[model samples]
Target: MVTEVRGFTDPQKEEYFRKRFRDEEQASRIISHIKKARSLHIMCHIPVFCWITATVLEDVLETREGGQLPQTLTEMYIHFLVVQAKVKKVKYDGGAETDPHWSPESRKMIKSLGKLAFDQLQKGNLIFYESDLTECGIDIRAASVYSGVFTQIFKEERGLYQDKVFCFIHLSVQEFLAALHVHLTFINSGLNLLEEQQTSSQTEEHFYQSAVNKALQSPNGHLDLFLRFLLGFSLQTNQTLLRGLLTQTGSSSLTNQETVQYIKMELSENLSAEKSINLIHCLNELNDRSLVEEIQQHRTSGSLSTGKLSPAQCSALVFILLSSEEDLDEFDFKKYSASEEALLRMLPVVKASNKALLSSCNVSEEGCEKLLSAVSSQSCSLRELDLSTNSLKASAVKLLSAAVESPHAKLNVLRLNICELSEGNCEALSSVLSSQSSSLTELDLSIRKLQDSGVKRLSAGLQRLNCKLNTLRLSGCNLSERSCEALCSVLSSQCSSLRELDLSNSDLQDSGVKLLSAGLKSSQCAVETLSLSGCLITEEGCTSLASALSSNPSHLRELDLSYNHPGDSGMKLLSAGLKEPGWRLDTLRSRMFPEGPGGSSVASLLFAAGPPPVCCDLHRPSPTLLISAVSAPWGLVP
Candidate 1:
């Protein structure tokens, strides 16, 4: 059987908690104060959160006369951390007076635990084993003595082999410990060696500059939240609480000043939007209200023009503006200026954004090279890219193909339509399509000059076992019968993953259709949609298509033979295939011939089998004709 526990507001539960405090009045005051903080009050609904709140509030009440209490999540955690430290130190000293910060054993345990946490966090592992603790110089026996600190933030579990496994209670707790490790390591090092070599102010400056550089160098944003916590811990109030718990020195004015300058310099040098946004968060934690306001003002003042700002500067400006808004996904570059600077600024945005649109941006080979370089970075997050209507050539295509092949790239949709591609471009693109790491699923190369040789190269890629391209658009690329033959081989191959093929408005004729039909008849062909619009196919080609359509368990669902002269004889053969029990073709479209016996007879035969379960469009007289079998069926009659 299962039982449900009542919430904090339950009278019996409230009475029980009130007794845990010194008096009922103290409990009431603490509860009243927490209720004033809207966010904190909601968190109190969790029993663990309520317990932490009560503990911190009780300490604040006992320590001084009307002292300021923790109001935010970070402040509350810091207070709880200090309380745990004091309790642990008292137990370790066995009733003797001792400073926790100065205790050798306490310092050793903190350092060891912090190092273990930092290393595991980098590996993206939250759970640890007995071996991991031993490797970090942490004895299992000592870990039990520090159970109060560890148990508050980490949960210990028994493994199947009777060994111990440990994980943080929350991810934020791990981040906090990692930040504390960096801070104490630097400050402790400075006190030991730098103080003898230079003044205390100089040592503090060195510590701040070193820490800032270390945090900024991490491109993956792994150190983001940790850096923010480090800055927050630099506050005087937080430092006071940590004085005897972790550190002996107060917060340094020099460290704060140096940190601000170092961060600004790093922001100006790097063009990553993710890194810049993290730096801003750290600045907020430092409580430098003026610097944050100045950066925001600079972005909104419109002084940072595409032509005037450098790439790094433009990236910083754009990131600052975008982070101020709530829904970043809605931000578009529709009206953005088509300049090198603008494209460069978008590089960082593309690396962090899920969708990127740079259509009609007048991008050239140089811009393509830079953009590809950004996409191939270790921190790239782009999944879709649109460079349509650009002027990319073979060199740009090669660069882009290399980027797509990078293991770090996550691009799934790529559109380079009307980009002036050539046979050489196709060769480069084919290499990307064949790469095992390539993530491309949709490719558009329409309206460019990719003749027989280009299509042949792309077909070679399609036949590769590793190629996973599902949708391909190669319309109006001057392809011939030879190109169709190459694509036919891809469809006939058992390893092919191609699903949709569009060869519309090309130079292909009846011979090309006949060649494609041979592959379509193969059981290995998985294509579902085939568009051969305006390929000059005649009745002879339709006979071959009919044979393929009647093959056992056909995969074709939609066929377009429109804008071609596939006369009455062609329709009769296609109608016969539609009547076959094994045929899966559901939609067929063909252009209307002149008003003769051929046109009427073909139309009647299409519906002769009691209006077959397929939608057929035979355009006649008007170009915009609608003969509906399904809902909202409209067709173009050319």
Candidate 2:
């Protein structure tokens, strides 16, 4: 009945010198596996700079610490460079070189580490979680172990990715500034690169060479290397990647809007009208949901209206308006009229193919209804229909009722934001929301005059709705505790598939928050993100929230409570929950405090450090708070 000893032995567990050569080999295998997993995470990000940076850093650290480099260095390095080469091929003009040959030393490192790591994986003896906190506050995670080197290196590489992306944007801004010099000092500099190219009357290669030479002769007025690089990229790239870089680089500097404008104009000047149109279309095609969302947030209605877009850019605008339907429920349409005419003109082109585009055209009931009906009859692919600021009386609600119930309804997004709808309309819209035809994913009813009675009317309809409606925004909806109770009841019921709920700018205080939290505690709530900005709740409300978050919980990953003025006390209360491992919060972004010195706003306090593993961002008000505030457990200062 005696069990055979098979696991790691005491000799292997002892100090490096105490272990046999076999034990050392076993430990190395474990380290190697961890390095491979870490490498996957790093390789996911493109442009091998991060990997290169990590390798160089590892080399530097090895030099300083007088230790051997990790066994998997060569494999990680090659994988990193391969990613860079791939991204470069797609992003850079003239394409990137491949099959780069590493040195013999590198090859040897790869062969040695690859075999060792593979053997460990095959043996199934790797420890994925190898660190824990010691008695002192300092985390004792993998910092001293041999594998700790690669883990440290991976973190540094990830950090390098962030820094490099940030620096790339900054360098782009500098290039824009260099281009701006053309408008200031260089406009009449007697030497224009474009003009020089046009009139040189020399061989194309020689002329371009001279132009590059002249461009780089002096930094005083010359474009920086980044700009030169950008020009080269645009000249040799295909339509898609070029357009992506143009949109990204152009939009990076929102503060320097004028500079961005100039750069776009300069780039456009070199292209034909057709190409410019396609470029604008490509910008509209930016399908990276995250980046587009960031842009939508920063660029508001007023700003968009004032921004200049040529006739060719209109189709792109139409596309954005169309795609916006997917989440029109969250938008505040009143803020987006930017030259109503420009928006109106694109509607027809967008609606040309939809027979249901202009349904429910009863102008007598409400202006919004008439517009909705008129568009319903058209044969256009109308994805988003914005009627936020209009009086969408009972008639408009009824129009939507039909569209939502019809199985063939093409409408996926319907925005009724800021509409002054009555209780009757709410009930009617509830039917629409519950209908099988509605493919709505996002619905923003913020700033609507919906009272408790309205919510009560719609609760049943919401519970029965089968649409994949993940994001629900109801900011400033005049919801009371009673309304919250009813809503919570629905959420705890069968309709528990929601992912995000934004209840900002509402009248709900601690009582409402408590009720919502209680409902969320139910097993039926599958929400992943929540927002309660400007709810006027106190620190005590946060205590209730913390309690709910720390409890055996749901899938919540992000929670935002911006503009709530909860102060330090409320923040501390939330921090308590964050310190607990039970809490599943990942992105806790908020802008709660006032701006600090150098115009740094207090919103940056949300990401400030405390005792938990979290990212503190105090940059909204100013990044200076990280310097001046008392450092907390989250790693951010107040």
lDDT (0 to 1) per candidate: 0.69, 0.46
Tens-digit per-residue lDDT, 1-638, candidate 2: 32332322223222322232245554454334333333222222322323343444344343345433332223333233333333334343244343333333322322322222222222332221212112212133322321232222112112333421001112222232233222111112323333434442333333333433344343342333323332222222221222221222212223223322333443334332223323332232221123234435535544554554444344344445443323222323233334333333344443533322222222234444434453454233456665556555676578766755555445666667766678898788777667665666667787787888988887767788474666777877878778778878766776645788888767688898889888777777778888887676777678777777766354777777765556676766665455456667655555443434465433333334211333343322231322112333333445
Residue 456, model 1: lDDT of: 93
After TM-score superposition, the amount by which residue 536's alpha carbon in candidate 1 deviates from its true location, in angstroms, is 3.1
Q: Show model 1 residue runs off by greater than 4 Å.
A: 1-80, 86-198, 203-227, 240-266, 270-274, 288-354, 360-383, 391-396, 406-410, 538-540, 551-553, 567-582, 590-638
Model 1 residue 421 lDDT score: 87
Cand. 2 Cα-lDDT: 0.46
Clashing residue pairs in candidate 1 (N, C-alpha, C atoms within 3 angstroms): none
| Model 1 C-alpha lDDT per residue in residues 464-566, reported as the tens digit of each score | 8899899999977778899989998998998789889999878688899889988998989999988887677789999888878777346887788765667
The superposed Cα distance between candidate 1 and the true structure at residue 623, in angstroms, equals 20
